[model samples]
Target: MEKEFYIDLIYKSFSGDLSEEEQNQLENWLSESEANKKEADVLEKTWQLSANFSKDFEINLDAEFAQLQDRIDLDEKGNVQEAIVKTMPTIRKKSWWKPLSVAAAVLLLAAAVFIFNQNPATAEMLAMETLEGEMKEVALADGSKVWLNENSKLTYPDAMNGEERRVTLTGEAFFDITKNPSKPFIIDTRDAEVKVLGTSFEVRAIDDEIRTEVVVKTGRVSLGKKNDLKPIELTANQKGIYNSKTGKKLNYEVKNLNSISWQNNMLEFNDLPLEKVLEDVENHFGIKVILENQDLLKCKYGSLFPDAKEAEVLKGISSVFKMKLVESGERTYRLKGGDCQNTSE
Candidate 1:
């Protein structure tokens, strides 16, 4: 295959312009060998880098293109083969400010050369998340740590610079921020901004949900809205809730830090509705517990389940509520029964 044809296919693939035949051809070529796939990867990365190239540095295009063209020619003629591998180092050393014939040449050469040599870790920002039934631990460059809850996402820059350390959160996460008195740590949720110098806290902010919650485990945290000036400050064992639509703050204190008991693989239900309990179970265990009768959800119970198997918890619930547990599907169960008041064994 002509090398330019593959290059054109790479451009089309990145631009989402690949037709069925072109996609099939590219896939076939890629599957033929690992080298072809690596070549494709290089081309794709180059295309992306060219699209988002930082304008801070001036790139030399004419000299770079000529050097690249020479390598291509040598490869085509099967001559000067020893120089092929050395072309990358030469391209890396080329100045970015040199004059080019056209913008197209700049994009192609800069992308193909600089992108190939760039370190992926230098990217401006990184995003992380936890899938269902999984909790993840992430250490930021600034020494802060984050424990992402199941089905949660956190987006932060590779390095924390500027006047403040900022991160965006969706769903829930427990943060253990490293103390930097000059630079306060700020969390941007859907409804509120949580500011703390150095503290351990939990933020729960679900998209489209009416309320955003923050619980400070240690140190202090300030909760404020984007449009409001008076921020609600809370200390350890204190909780704050922000109404997303109404812009109201509700602050309170809890008896213990058991609100984050899930960190220890424990589920604590403090007289919560059965419906909410089942939802928490599903979120933590990655299962579906369907209430066969909606009325059954009215039953409320409080208990602590520590590292117990799903079956054991299900059996306990069945005995407590006098309900029947039936298998609906894999990792799914149906609870069938009428609502019963809290029963003592």
Candidate 2:
């Protein structure tokens, strides 16, 4: 078969515009060899994804056509170089049809690339959001998973179409990525970006926060600004912090065992101080915990509340420290008591 005929067949197959005879001919050709079948399968799947995305996202055809025209102009410029060489009678005499054949192939290949790229469409962007006091779980198209925290939003593509599986984050989320060595998963945030092959990690990029953070639970992650040349890399049980204002890699930490605790609906205090425990509680419940008596911050508490309510956690902490828990304002609570080493409970 001629190369142009095969290229046309592939293009027709991609668009699902192939006639019955053409489809049968293509199917027979594919079934002829394993390699051919694989190529056809890849093309079909990629085209399907693009076709679906194109339906949802209206492409700027005028702009896209303009870009294609520019590329074609560049290709024509290359043809001009071939024209200069054509002036040589000896080269022309050596092969009368060779130059024409070469030019045809070049133009055909360029046209194929431009047409394939333009019609399949760009990646289809999708998003997930959670309200205050709510959390959501998302299953990505690539078999990866995400746990979106309260008041957070995550934007991902319906299909990961390029060299990387990229998603944008606006608040906090825990990602459990599926392994795809050829295509690394990337989390894009306002302050920083996180890249990994197939890893589970937590990313926090709250709008008002002074810093954006990445806590890796498994595998390895590269964390820094999206365009940073040398982003800080982290492995399991490691964390990377970035200063939002300066866009600097602030620091790295080695422990983040409870990074995904909130996803499990569990609050764990492992020999944590009263001050830190309150901070965690505040973050988890979107509430403020204040110490009316400054000395109450000195207490070290250790406990676990699995699937516990907000009131239960407050009451538990108050009873153990012998502190008075009082509501001061909406979504705010105060701990009034003495400084005591309350590691007993």
The residue ranges of model 1 lying beyond 4 angstroms of the native Cα positions read: 1-136, 148-153, 160-163, 170-172, 179-183, 204-211, 215-220, 226-229, 235-239, 243-247, 252-264, 290-296, 322-328, 334-345
* Per-candidate local distance difference test: 0.64, 0.64
lDDT accuracy of residue 135 in candidate 1: 85
Score every model by TM-score: 0.49, 0.51
Candidate 1 lDDT, tens digit per residue, 191-249? Answer: 56777744566666565444555665555667777535888776544556655545566
- The Cα error of candidate 1 at residue 31, in Å, is 88
Model 2 vs truth, CA RMSD: 31.1
